[model samples]
Target: MLLTEEAMKTAIILKMLSALEYDVFDPSEVIPEFTADVGIKKGEKVDYAIRVGGRISILIECKAPNAPLDLKHASQLYRYFSVTDAKFAVLTNGYDWEFYTDLDEPNRMDRRPFLTFNLTDIDTTSASELSRFRKSVYDVGAILSTARRLKYISALKTRLKEEFDNPSDEFVAFFGRQIYDGMFTANVRQEFAPLVKRSVSEVIRDRVNARLKSALLQNTTEAPEEDIDLEEKSEIETTEDEWDGFRIAVAIAARVIDPSRVVIRDQRSYCGVLVDNNNRRPLLRMYFNSPTTRYLGLFDGEVEEKVAVKAPVDLYRYADRICATAEKYKSAT
Candidate 1:
């Protein structure tokens, strides 16, 4: 763990720079404790500075692992940005790294980070963006050109996530006005808000299910002979709700095991999720045969416990138990 700022600088920051083909030992390429003249302050120091062709191109500020990389924490980097010949500034706490550039104005650091990501939980998009900073292919012109677009895209994604969790009045009204012919009154707005939220959730869930189905189909070319025979004998039809439940179960179990390993097997009685398509290593079961009520069969104990679920989303409530079951199966292997 990078407890101190110095520890974070040497352990995490330096290693990242090294991976980017920046020579950590070379003072011209990676300068530590780079001094910047901040107006009256003669020797104000930035944590690190990366130079390209003997000119400082990137300035980095390091903090302890637990420290927040907010604007207030980036005061030194903000100050040094104007004085030094650097286009980009990075503020990081070993785990979370925030990349800032002068998008709003020239030579002035923007209030918001153009790019931000956590080292531990980096997505594909974030990884792509981070690759641009590599010393071998570092281009100031190309990076700045895409930085503005990436900034807005990141902001829009954040806004969408917020709206997904809790739809704002304007966001709800925007859709309500389009759908309803009548005047979008206060009562109408209140009525449509929950509906909009539900609709958005359902759309996202459907997309997730589609992707999961595609992955499952790719993994399994043909149905197992046993399953084929069973389906032939009994008219076993899997419902949309069962698929939703299975997707939710796979998502929950994914914390402990791979999603592809959690395969779904449809039987007349219930839809079973098994580890590596093994019946003996059952993860969970979805008993959605009844229209009035549904149940999630958990196998944390000796006997399978059927827990009542109102909807597929309710499966998230038992994530701990589901993950525990997956962990047990994973450890057994």
Candidate 2:
């Protein structure tokens, strides 16, 4: 693990620069311990300066693995930014990397980073964004153009996650006003806060399950001759409600087993969820045939217990039971 600033530089940052096609050994491309005069401070030193076309383009500030890459730690980079020719500044602590640009003002780094990503949890989109800073394909004009949008999008995503977890009074009131017809009192706000949070969580889980189901369907091949005969014998019609309940069950079971292992098998009477698509290893069943009420069939070993549910969201109330059933099946295997 990277412990010190020098270890972080040599172990992580240098390798990242090399991956971006910057020759670490070339002093002209990757300058280490770069020093320059800044205002009244004589010979202020920045950690590293990346040069392109014989000019400094990116200034990097590194901190120890235990240190937080806050504005205070980037004091040198902030001071050297105005004096140097670099348009971008990076603050990193071996794991979390924050990229800042002068989007708010000319020749000054913004207080907030326009782009931020973690080395440990990098995704394809973050990888593509990071590629714009590569030595071979560096485009200052293109990056600057999208820098503002990326900054705001990142901020919005962070705020949304925050609101999802603990929603503010304004957010709860916004939804409460639409559905609720009574006076919007403080009592009502308190009552609706948990409801709003739970609803948001359910909606997000439902969307994720839908995406997984779509991808699974796309990759599914034709069934074998024996399964085809079994499919022909059962005249099954899976409803939207059944699919929703199956998705909810899958979401709950995900806590115990891989979601791909949970499969939906619709029969004439009910919709069954099984482990590894095997009928003998039943997880749960959904009975949505009744127009007035719906029921969830949960399993305890070989015995099935049918519980009446109002909607798919009600299945969340039995999440512990569903997870226990999945755990039992998993342990049996």
Candidate 3:
């Protein structure tokens, strides 16, 4: 099932813990509604609390999808951190996780995390490093060290980007020396200015592409299937409201059919079961990733189903039936 932002965050965090070899205890055992008077008490709650030996060891707060970790929100977590014995704190919204530790002062967390990890997108090495946070292998000191490294790395990258955006005289001179070594002349500074600009633009483009690729990879991993055996599987090319109709349709089929029978090709677009060859039924006539779900069932010709979903994540909510629906779609075709 497509997971809601909150659910997704919880799932990813749990997955991280599992990867670290931590004994993934029940969420209910650790995460409980805030009942104590700990300052702000207007229905606010921490997303999770990690426990060790039946005692709270860490406090975690979660933000909604795409929400920024502004000062106000971080302060709330800070307050909670001070009150709890859990020296470590975490703030996450599925994609980015920021860890906090009170190394500088009592109840005051460092400006930087003890460690930071991004779930949906990360390099293999970064992923392996992040895996150390798993329940079993968790070492407070080790995490702190890693966090320090990440902080410096982050600062270095930020400064590099800043320089790339607004080149400095020193930066220009250094590159000039490397690229035009031995031929360096007074004119070399002016000559390499365009090169610097070009390099900056290329770096920006590469970063954008990396983000796009990560998103694509995440989508593919979420959508697990090769092809569905349904004839006349129609595919729609359009946008919708909250959820992607075609994806929901494909998921429905995926839930029901044998894993081999259902196949989701091309990630978001062009999905359906291949019942036979000469005929392919397209589930979606006009597809979209938003709320208004659309699907076409080709029994003989075409049948349309417009499903309204509350959230984009709900597309995968019906994972079981979604798979079943794929088989049904295949059989119908």
User: Highest lDDT among the candidates is held by which one?
Assistant: 1
lDDT of 2 by residue, 1-333 (tens): 555778678767786776566889999889998887557267668889999888899999888885777898568888888888999999988778899989998998899898887665444345557767867668899889889999999899899999999999999999999999989999999999999999999999999999989855853652421344555645567887777667656655655666667778776667788877766778888888888977889886469999998766456567667777888888664
lDDT for each of the candidates?
Answer: 0.80, 0.79, 0.54
Model 1: per-residue lDDT, tens digit, 141-181? 99999999989888999999999999999999999999899
lDDT score at residue 74, model 2, on the 0-100 scale = 69
lDDT (C-alpha) at residue 59 in model 3: 78
- Per-model TM against the reference: 0.64, 0.66, 0.50
| lDDT of candidate model 1 versus the reference | 0.80
Error of 1 at 305 (Å): 42
In model 3, where do residues sit more than 4 Å from their true spots? 1-28, 35-44, 162-170, 173-191, 197-333
Alpha carbon lDDT at 29, candidate 2: 86
- In candidate 3 the C-alpha lDDT for residue 54 amounts to 69
